[model samples]
Target chain A: MGAHTMEPASSSWVTLLGDSDRRGGTTAARNTAPKELLWKVTLGDSIRSSPVLAAGVVLVTCRDGHLYAFDARTGRERWSYATPASVHSTPSLSGDLVLFGCDDGAVYAVDRTSGGLRWKAQSEGAIWTSPSVHRGTAYFGTHGGVFNAVDILSGRTQWSRRFDGRIHSSAYATDDRVYFGCSDGCVYALASSTGADAWRYQTGEGVTASPAVKDGLVLVGSEDHVFYALDAGSGAVRWRFQTGLGLASSPAVTAGKVFFGGKDGHVYALAVADGREIWKSPSIRQITAAPLAGASLVCVQGFFGTTQAYDLNTGDTLWTASLGGSLGSTPVITDDTVYLATYPGVIYALR
Target chain B: MNRRTFVYNAALGTLHVGLLGTQLRAFQNTPSAPTLQIDIQAPDLPLSKLAMPGLFPGRVVQASHAGSLLNGRVQQAPVGQMLDQGMRALTGESTSKEAWAKFIEPSDIVALKVNPSGTPTTTTSIPLMREVIRALNAVGVPNRNIIVFDRNSNQMEVLGYHNLLPVGVRVVGLDGDWAIGGRTRPGYDPNVFAEMNCFGERETRSYMGSVVSEASKIINLPCLKEHNASGVTGCLKNLAYGCFNNVARTHRFPKTYTDPAIAVLCTAPPLRAKAVLHIMDGIRAVYHGGPFAWNPDFVWEAKTLLIGTDPVAVDRIELEMVEQKRRDVGAPSLWDRNPQNLGSAADMDRSAQKNRFYREPGHIKTASELGLGRWELEQIELRKLQIS
Candidate 1:
């Protein structure tokens, strides 16, 4: 059975980059990469969509056009929902539904438990980013340059706005604004209620990376090799930190520090308020996905097979282990365990 | 003049009589002025302030890294190093960033036209692309202004161009000027097009991609591959075929219009003025089965990066390297026109020594004659570097 609850009665991850503690808190303070492999399963294709966990089930999307559910403890396949094209969008759980966008230009809601299709709302172009569900609505962007806000219950489009570029960046919603990156090289703050452009800050390049909002500031990375912190209300750049390469991964904030990875092959931690460099790990190859920031440690996957975890405070390498295949997705941390997916379609459960 | 089979074939027959050499010589017989009916029309747009053969005219840099490829996979460090060295040498600048500033500006929307149709076997190396993006960033070009694009979005996605580059830099694949067959699509500019009637096709115009048309400058990143239609697929050919829509019609089986079309396309406004740099990726190249590395045996790691503002000059050097590789492999050169030497049309991989068309490797020379860049090998100052 599926349930729609944040920080449920136990430690679980409800969304991409979502996690809870043993106290049933919403903070994904996962501090370490577990040493032992619990179970590992290979999907039909590469796992670009990060895994979301709830109710002892691990949900992951694959380029094979399927949303697969596996027993978290056993790594045994429970069910899988197939789509016409690949699913690059990570799954967002709403009640009993698992919602995501697909390469076929449609957003589908599948029953989380049975992996059966609930409803499909179509867009004119391919959807490469995940749906951000807030206030009973799902928000996402499409290659057609249209960002759609659909009702979570009925999978019906409530409103849409067309931009000059595709919305490859997923949405991060605040109380009033939904922040997302656009191909036109701008980070937009759209009104959550009306889908109107509240304010936009242009970056040097497209903003494919999602915004991570905290304390009135929205943090996102641009292909311009710089990470920016913008004011949530006015979209003004408060501070910007240049990286060695372009940023693809979203920032993870914990204890006033933000951690993110760059295409330049380093894991970086900077002050969230001023965008000053606190510490940066040595070059480790290109990191494409967001690092899983727990309370004490932040974990990132190299484009290659190795996954490394560093201390959130000192940026010291805490642990390094191979996750079997080249990692194209982010590391997902749940209470007591860590999940890493690879481009070759392998999913590893380490505890 | 629209290049016709009668004129192209007759000229080749006459040229072949005196040219007991490679196919590049075939282009020499092709006069600078066309005898065929061909028309090139660019939109009434502002010409690029920075045009081809920029900074150093007739100069080319060959940067080779011994560790550019590891077990056939692209090595990032060596690729990045090679780019830095190549850019520094090409611009005679002390740093790569300073060199990039010679052509690219902070406000300019630079299009990095990539060759990605070949997919996994060979395309623009991802590592080199990253370095180019980084270099552009170093010069203060916003990631939004630096576009990594190809004609086919499908091929670009398959090659991981979107994932390979940093976020914020636009990785766009327009699919083509035409979405389905030869029909016009929004991705193509209705204003700018190359008009030529080939094979009696009703649609004679191939539009310049809307993405490239919108950009202020272009940096060509083409792969070192042979084309079944055009013998030498280099910088000019990449821009000619990669940016224009409905280009496949230029070559039907054994016939081709790539020679005049490619050279003339480069001479057209907008493209001629916007395209300022050419970097040919020869790190992993296809000596045969070009356009695509259809055969693994034909793909080799040349570990070379050809950089220059003169597309024609860089392409000429690339062709010679491919020719030399063909010689080493005991395979017929791309210029070999002996139909008897061609493998079965059904399967070229079976007989690795195969000729798809009397490949117009001479397109490089034709482009040179069209005033694109230096075509004569003796005129080009090639600076070769073996990166330790």
Candidate 2:
């Protein structure tokens, strides 16, 4: 691993940035719904990957067999790098390098500022999960059921461990451990230093949902429809909540409330302690987007053109809007702006 | 109007067969007892000239045949001649179904289960799809009553299917709005899908599918291709694509009845066994990435169309072509690399690596064993029509 420093830069509130992750639309930050469509740029093919904003540049991966960088506000083509196959993984920014996995079974690191290529590490299967960085260690899962830990700067492999199935879930990083789940029905905690297994807990079915850790407790959901809270250090199950269906959406923890969506067409808020139910709201359709929480608002997106914001405490509706298409992307909230993506190849910015 | 009149004449003949007692012998000769094993013995006459026997009598009759010319072992002919022979071999009746159904009313709906997921180059051709629609229309099957469906939206769009079909002949996809509306309430299993089997055990799952069940007659238009997991995807593959929520789950246990499960799921009493006619599109064969073509090189242009009511027989024949291609390419058979034979669950063998093409599709054999159709090539009447 090498010493790394990510430049601190800001993106203007005027333009929309990022890849068409999940769905195509991105929410804009404004008092009124996005009116001024920034510059729209066309690539070679449809983009299924999400875009991440860092250092004033938007890093996007496209099915057109390229990883692209553009000015966040201007949508001007900055630079582009071609790959062997599709890049479905959303690029994660770590310092000056952007890390992403491609369908060609390789993890690539590119210069975030210059859009220049850095280093590439190969995997057995395609990498659809975004690489999560922590303490100079980068972690991500692959289609071949392997979780790899690589040095972010040099792209050297630290260690690799195999599971029973594919790993579509992205990695979550804390201080010493990188936690994630796989299609093999197991959630694993590995030491970020050497990729050695710290702990593993099996679920009923596959665990494609990502994990979110806070304060020594790791919260994650599984395809088995069970939401689990594990001991951050030992990977022991602290509490598990059984939903009516498989849980694909990652859990978002705020205060004492854990918000997530179940495939049974319901968005649930559960007490993080002992896995008790708090309040449940029936989404009009299956909720694929992870829930985003602000001060008093819980924003949820559904697969069938619906997005709603509810009062965090009482489950009261704050606002509801039809996006005119299915939305699979998680909404990112920044002050007053909420950004999301839809399937019809358009991103919407809602204020 | 002439074709409609011919259908009317055929319907009158069918009525006469129903009324007369002499037709019982023709029905007795229909060969209802399903043949199990494959016999290599050649039939007495050439299959092309032979009139293929029918399974059901009064209701079903032969429609016109359709075929495409190939470079080797086949010749090219006019479109009308090629389509007529192919349609004749497909329907097996001398006249259209509308003519034979004058005494009995014609069906209101016809579902065409198309293979949009096959390799792009070898997928069902637009001409073939158009001919099927045209022939059905000649039999008085209205355009509004016809529907062509597939598993994926992108695949259907790639094959240029949306533009080929007439406006009345709706083309539907799995992810499309109309198909999504067909989704029912969540079954016993809480998976994202609408249906489920029993808990804790994996067996043949029984669930309601509006598209599969509601069709008056199903015309399965599947592309013949090599499948990495299921051995070969053909008419039987349609069952998997048409019924299940997530097909990737079927690969959990290797060689575990994926092919047979699809066949059983469709052939079992209520789900589909009633009204299905398979039209295997061999226009372009995907010798390899299959189910989805990632590599364009693996595709080959084998212009042929295979029609059969029995899915097992159709797939067995198709699988034979895949095996021959692999053999010609000097590669291993699907059996040699079958992943199911890997390290046992009881013994974790560190050296165990998954065989890429692991496991022969047991479904066809199992389907044959269940008394569906003949597995051997000898029993099938291979009608090699010279389209040119």
Candidate 3:
């Protein structure tokens, strides 16, 4: 089979934590509060993967070890394929193939249209990071400290690197480099083509948050309670902001503003240039997942199971909806719908 | 008669419940009736077999000190002394140090699996944990090697356990990140798990905590309490549910009993092999409204500590003690769910009436069936001592 290389439409979210850049920043505008409810579907178990919309289908993985595809508008079950173990890794769409890793230590490529297995490549440990597919190569890391670059079409390893600790951070791929965080408390930048180490920035604690690279700054958070921005080329620290506790939330950069949630339960908006706090919201419970920055509103899913939307420019609270269960997955923002998943296996499509 | 009626009759000490033929036959050969005979022979059996006498065989030591608790706090000195006497009695060793040496060594990394759930009054007392640490230290296990842990980090933090323990004694909460992600943190070892399809749950496997897999030995420290779902939660439930992740999926709506699940978990190779000691804190026992401590009226100064290697045997004794306490308070039996007695103090003061599920105290016997330990009253030799 030939590799499908259709560019995602500007409005589609085709990868985990938004696009392959892992920016989680969207430009699609939508009403903050819609009067009507869309549709909701229950899955087999809790979901930790953010939903990705590709070609009118919403794709999400469940703790029950299944990847489910639902009709985006109607919430009808399209198809589901089960893996050997639970999947926390969000799926990346590459043409007609869906690529994701599983806790069973295998990276799978499934046909998007028929839900059939295309190819599977085994890894040494459980994969918690979503695959970042760039130029027909899938890049991801596993808990076993193995970072792999697999060919998307044939499911063959191009190159693999070993680290000292687990990797939970998904890779953010640019034209030349891929950036990710590791449990060994380091943010690593590697060449996209050869899987060679480009630069490594050490943090005080483990780095589980995926890197958000905008302009020339690489922004990531560490469990050491510090949010760091480093020079993308030199790996030198540009600025660091300390919070009350550690941070596992990835930053969402949009419109010259960087938005991130902290383990201390506060959401902070900072200037992308100098890392100055623009606004800090009150404690909304521990924010572990990345904040979704849409055109006019910034939506954050708190670990306490509430999804709240704030004014993107003012950081003012716009609307909040309780999912009634813990949420580890990031929220998906479309032009008309915001898809959120809760730990109790319920997926809510709110417009 | 229905199974419920038979259980009610059995709880009332009626002899006419013909439905209990198996139990009647099992009890007929017991010469001491309620008093258990000591059986020390360790049986060789498969993992599926339920008749292993290897877990402390037939002995259980219960040491009671009247002044162990004062002003709702456990006196460390008296509890330590009581622990010493109980260990001596349980192991047949003359001194506490000698008895402790039988179970632990200097080079071993010991994990003290403490139950930190429920209210302050019903949770494992910090004083008792100190005593356990002291005993471990006396046996030459270093402070760094001693880990005091519970399932939830937040609950342990809420109970002030992190600050209460000794400086070098590492306190860990296994599921610290559960609230954040719903998935248990990396603290659970994925390699070691108990897989069983109970009640058709989606997550059929319960992974053992990393502490259990890493430690050379585990000392199960459970508090004495009446669990609304499990009837009574003592040694078996503590090590079973406490040491494993994803156990809440076992007993959900429509069916709330953790019978086979608890037994399967406790008998899992990782726990069944590593867990060598069972020390149940009964100083403040809750006859009702527990696992969580909300109703003070149902709580009392039990002033007792049950120590044994046989979790099932210890749990069986705890079950009888809780049943007696429930009877003394005019509460319905754990098995007989009479909704008519809903507003009583023993029924979680009626606040937890709707939340309460069908109780499954028979998990102790189920563990015994799985060859985890002895559960029958006739098979257990209980040594009751007063350490004043």
Candidate 4:
């Protein structure tokens, strides 16, 4: 088996959007929201992939068909890899390699240190989900509903299974199971070893949000306007919270609170145990990206207009940044820095 | 003018249109639709000769080939045969190229409004999409002049339409942000729109998709799916709902203005004038819960294709096919307004069969009365082909 790193980096926030738990959108390493503007840089085009910080380098993909690596401190260009088509898959780190999916229908593994091509595994359709690295394997679902598990080091297919609906949800991997939501309106948990279906829980509309797993529950939001927490083993509904509209954004679980944004333009903080609303913010612009739950603050990247930071406990607005272009990428954060990418290809580092 | 006189003028057409200039874009008829109350208005724009019921009116062609789909994959040669046979039958032209040339020109910018809402299950067939692009190319329309589009860009990408299409063919998504009302919604023309008052909510105007305004002609690619709110979604709903922004407001739970609203939106001059063809993909038909793949149990391999210049006639047939399939499966009719079926369960991501709203399948007949096409069987001709 190829050696891949599953150990967490000391302080770097490496979530494509969320922490390893996924539905928990990066509240692990960061307990504070950065408030200072440290640096910003414009890339070739707009970004859809969230920035992942690893080894003092920020890795992000662009709509211009390029995967770029920048110095975490100065936002300086470190190295870059180019793909044939635009990339929506955020760079996921596994061992010495940085893996991401591309619109060219390939899962690319590039050298993390030099951005050199290690191997590229082609799939049947374009992959929009981030490669979920688990136990020396990279898992992802494609736009065509083809799910593949590739060897992390060799970039060879381990096994593949096709579902009935398209898959936009990135996979959430545990030791024994991998979970993902599908446009077929179902949350699916597959046996990690064999890539076989373990259980499936149906939702009303399509589920594009990636699943977040913690405490034996798989949590995800569906386009049907419901946030569901399902039993990990059997896929039974543990609880569900209804929102005004559907959810394209995933959730962040931290300190027993689940923070999420809704397509209906509201930010919600709920108790993780029973899906009870702790606090719901007033309506704002629509949000399609997951929120970052910190120790005292929760930050949300809006689909347009502004990115706001709210009091984690009270849902009170703390700060708002009205960036010129639209914000779509889910921002990553550290203890004192927030690295966000926006439309028209601009990246901002808040410290 | 009184309502009676207005009705008289509406029947008289363009003559009364100029005289009653203020009400020129007025409601075509006062439909006593039980569930929905709607008033539609548009600017009095000039109608093109190739509008709505273009070239041949009241004619529909159904092409069914059992071989079109082989083991879950759409077979290329068989689908090509289906398109060829359906087009030839619809136009009465010996050659497929000649049939396509009836409406499309080498200079025209053709917009293909494809439904990607229900991917993998009921979305436009990739084979059919490719075939349409090939047919357009054969008609001397270059790939650059072709635009394939849907309502949501995200869904389009998720469905892989952009990657599948030819390089030069433009793929666009008409503005999103259904609930966020503001100038935030781009990709829609502000000037050309259909204004209506349906559920007493604000923002009564629905704008035309910006791509529709730029294109000279549109070839509709609607899937055969039973819509929860509008009954069966075919041509009229495809063009009307697909081309307009903020249209989901027409259906809100217990009721919807989908009937008259759909027909009235079809009468909008800019949209109605440019829609020259309708091709319904029935390869995988969703008979019960749909527009979304709400339930895969309701999906059946219909192996059928429909073609027409008359939306109302084609949709009527599409409606019948969906209803019959529902009946065969012991499912409630799309037109089933039985009070017992309605449920107030907070609409969540639960795909239950509880009839939520009174289904408004009469949109087809309302569209016919709006002069889009023929609705009655006696007024139309259907040519069916069985291809081996």
Candidate 5:
């Protein structure tokens, strides 16, 4: 049986803060030039998870165990909820509820308006991956090595599938299919509704990068040191990119190119058509942060607390900023500003 | 069908979906339970010091004596005899009391820096620490004079040291005082290790220079273990823990030579000379999948004790024992990493091979490069004795 799929829960549109509707569609008015520095927010610890933007609130999870809500424009903290463990998974916003996994071993649903707890379902191990929400069900992976689909309001599980290793990536759902990878060297496409397996692709080693779905293709990186593309429908091999080192970052797909950082120290832009390297940058030592896709820029976070912007057209280095320590958090860009947090507790709103 | 039957059918359909989710959630939340292997061994008898290697290239100082116990039995000798052995190995006829005074005085507050990086379930062995406390008291050191410490309080609590601290001794974890007002300068830093050390340059800007400098003497208590990233986690690893701002840079890349970062960490400011003595806890050892192992069964119960005033002698003994134990266990040596270990052994041999200078421990050799201690191991005398 294939991995199950769930019908869309709410057909009613939920208007969020973005110029485009949710799912990160690009707006025509985005500025392509280098932006200025906006305001900066200092956190108590490093921000390791990506920030999710929705419902006028930018949700960020910090290593200090707090899920912070900030005004997307002003960077003022709206409300913060403390978890029993670190919040390594970026929160998923579904309507008025924010769904995310915490290292505390629980999946939490908090009210979007008040930051109030709705319901929490406990997992066996720490939840380090961001959650993917569809219909009324939320799908996510856990350190316990399970991919789960949970009901939003009732905190009940729709279905779950087990793997031989831990899941470090958020499950990406498209139509009725859910795609995710495990550290056990496999990428799985499951039917979201019934929790049955659809198809699986074996990588050279354990897959730690989150699977990205674009144009019927599922792209992911593996510890075996390669980035792979597979047919979303049949789980057949589409193409593969052999990196000098293991691909630790999730593939960010845009404009027919897949950008990812390899452990061997280089950030490469690969042709999605054949997994051919279009252009590769010098090794950045360790590029683990998944690059953020934008209209004109590819934003990447790297070691020694550096954040850099590159021209999407030429892969030219545009500008760089110092974060003081490591930049583990992925950048979330707005129409006028790019917001990111560093491991040393500093949050920057670059305009 | 009747109207009631139709309503009941619709409700049942909704509940079926709910049931499917409940079952899935249960499966997702359930983790494979850890297989617990618990073994308790009676403390080994008649503890004796290991042989110290002779001179090498580095600046290594020899310890006049070796292991000495405190309040507990060593199975080797009485407290007085152990004191005599340690005294003969050291420079003076100073009693264990005088040695205590010289190492730490009543007014001098001492920091017993303990390496808690191994498994949280295991520690440096309670009986061994109790013996060190006994020795301190024998030397006229007060109960409150010594503070046992690590970087994280939660781990210390997991190891059951928090409740044990108030009993006339101080036990502190570096994270205990994480708040703004509670934080002390040069002690705890959250921002030190944000970058990679690939080019092998400086990685940190500010460090905890205060907490370490405030202590009169820092006694290093480390575990004997195998490290995949660094060759060994010994006294140098113990001292480097305080010197570096971040440790994640080493493991962020798999093939990166983390040993250089460790070597540089020992040579850094504040923590190098602060290491006054080296005591290796070899009771419960992890010869595989360490410095932290989830499977506790890998731990071997070896009732052995190693002590020396010279960090080099202490470390050299540990490196050899680690290699010897790996061989005894029928495992490949750490040098098999080939390229990663490319210059690791040669760099170590330069400081530890007993030839031109006194052979030293790797950390002692690195610290000696930073001018911390003598690197010669032969100058160390094995004042081995029975502590029963």
Candidate 6:
């Protein structure tokens, strides 16, 4: 694990919403839009998990209970692994293994190079959130509100803690603390080592959106139509911006700008400093997925089957594409390509 | 125009001009004096012989204050004062302390059953709930002994009741977090249930929550709204469905209305004996598309609270208020069976017309048949109060 951690940082997108920091690989020098469409592939079922690129291969999980690997450049199918139930969780890469949870109540670790199963661990309830690999441990939560920490190499549980509500949001981890939201209307920060409670901030409603931690604040949204910015160390509310409807879209913070979408059919951009609205683009219909910030662009998927890209700084419409099917999955952007999937099983790769 | 002619013209879609003229005339006239007493005596049974013995003897108090709401939000001070007046008027006590003491005791484990359904616009007001809690505290019930509960924890959290209530007051949800394939804890008492089959639903038995079983007494807090299945979700439906699980099966299809199901559930032993008071929040009433206030246009300011020990009697009066509001809004009667009034699948697909259910407003009368309380308006003793 230490040897792998010492490896030079590659420009690979290998996890749900891009890495444990959840910045979607945002960087100042890499901020430029992709040029045009590269390729497209049609699959068997809807894809709710965003595609993850690692080792020249793209890994995606579909509602048909199959995990597929395709060549990142040529769009050629490499292999596919079948599971017992549907997969809604995106794959997170830890060394040579790809980890993800399934609705069948099991977490699977497959070989990243070949789509072969390494080991599987059963959970008490449906595992809907994607797993985050930190150090040698894989952390995930279940619909039964139980958060589990497991050894990534052996597929053995290390420890688990149960809360009072469902855990629909994925866990975001730093070196010391882990942050996640629960259906019980609380955002909890726990010790990454022992899963002990660090602190918890109560919100006005259930929080299905995952938290994005940057600087000294943790940002998340709730079903009560409020977006909260909390002090990361003490769990104190710094500021809040209320929308017309509840927000299920996890926020993407890049260049001090926060981008998310609301069920009220609006996409919003806000300043991270004071939670003030920078600009809002309305009339997009419901957006249930997280926004992706990369390549100087902010992209959001609408539940009504459209994906819109806006300029990261100006909130202007960069481009729009109608996939002709409902979309609830976040898009993945590489150095020169954008990969998105529709609920009707179509994956589009645009450059 | 007279009432009969007006209703007939409304059904024919020709009452717009007449309704506007009537509204103008009503606005021109001085407000009528409040009626001190409305005597409604049931011929079959005497007031002393009722299902809930010694509970108002079929009497209910309707207390209203125009100042109850300001800027669409409940005024906390006015709500507290309004509750005090309503409690005194309902129990005929001279002081609020004396009135609250009549039903609550220091040793009692009092549970406040709240309805948190519907849109955020029309749930039980937090101000009203805080006032209820204050009254309970005034009567000597400890904060720890008072429990505020609903069926769905997700909905309860959305309302932030835990943060809104005083410290030590416990909030519980019967269904836990995720309802689908979620494990049922001891929160529900499997020993007690309301058994019935509606449309061959597999989960025929509705289990009662353990909170209701353990409570010494319950204060039912329900909102005023039009229900898609039971016509009006008032005191009876709130207790009947809110306290039990697997109740969604009671009204699956339009034809299988929640008539006897609601009455049966309310009359179950776990709920019938423990629930002692009914407080209906009418500050923001939904005349249609309710039980879920999805549309804001259907909501109106009622600025009133109905308090009583007799659930049936209170609901009977509540039904009238909702029907009257519907009439004022030019919507058809709750009992209308016309295809246009009942709505079709296409209409249900639309947002504005989704409230059109083959409504079972007769559930109130069905509960009356089960000896719950008085259903007929004529058999109720209503005392109307205008709070300053």
Per-model lDDT: 0.75, 0.57, 0.74, 0.76, 0.57, 0.74
In candidate 4, list every pair of residues with a backbone clash: A23-A212, A24-A253, A204-B349
Worst 10-residue lDDT window for candidate 1 chain B reads B13-22
* Per-prediction backbone clash count: 17, 41, 3, 3, 65, 5
For model 6, state the Cα shift of residue A231 in Å.
11
Q: Give the local distance difference test score of model 4.
A: 0.76
Interface RMSD for each predicted structure? 8.4, 18.2, 12.0, 10.2, 16.9, 8.9
User: How many clashing pairs does model 3 include?
Assistant: 3
* lDDT at A190, model 2: 83
Docking class of 6: incorrect
Q: What is the lDDT of residue A115 in candidate 4?
A: 89
Off by over 4 Å in 4: A1-47, A54-351, B1-45, B176-185, B344-353
- Assign candidate 3 its CAPRI class: incorrect
TM-score of each: 0.57, 0.50, 0.59, 0.57, 0.53, 0.59
TM-score of chain A by itself in each prediction: 0.93, 0.84, 0.95, 0.93, 0.89, 0.93
**Regions of candidate 2 where Cα sits further than 4 Å from its true position:** A1-44, A324-328, A349-351, B1-150, B153-388
Tens-digit per-residue lDDT, B273-327, candidate 2:
4334567777667665466544445566566666666666777778888788867
Candidate 6 lDDT tens digits, A1-351: 222234323336667666677775543223445557788888876676678776677888986788899887888899999996667788888888988999767899998777899999888556768898887888888775689889998999988899876677888888888899887779999999999999999886568788889888999988767899999999999999988777777888877878888866678888999988888886575676788887578888876678887877777888877774333477777556777877777888877
Native contacts present in each candidate (fraction):
0.00, 0.00, 0.00, 0.00, 0.00, 0.00
For model 2, the local distance difference test gives: 0.57
DockQ of predictions, in order shown: 0.04, 0.02, 0.03, 0.05, 0.01, 0.07
- Overlapping backbone residue pairs in candidate 2 total 41
DockQ of 6: 0.07
lDDT of 3 by residue, B90-193 (tens): 98889999998878899988989988777345788777887888888898998778877777764564344543355446566675322111233456766666
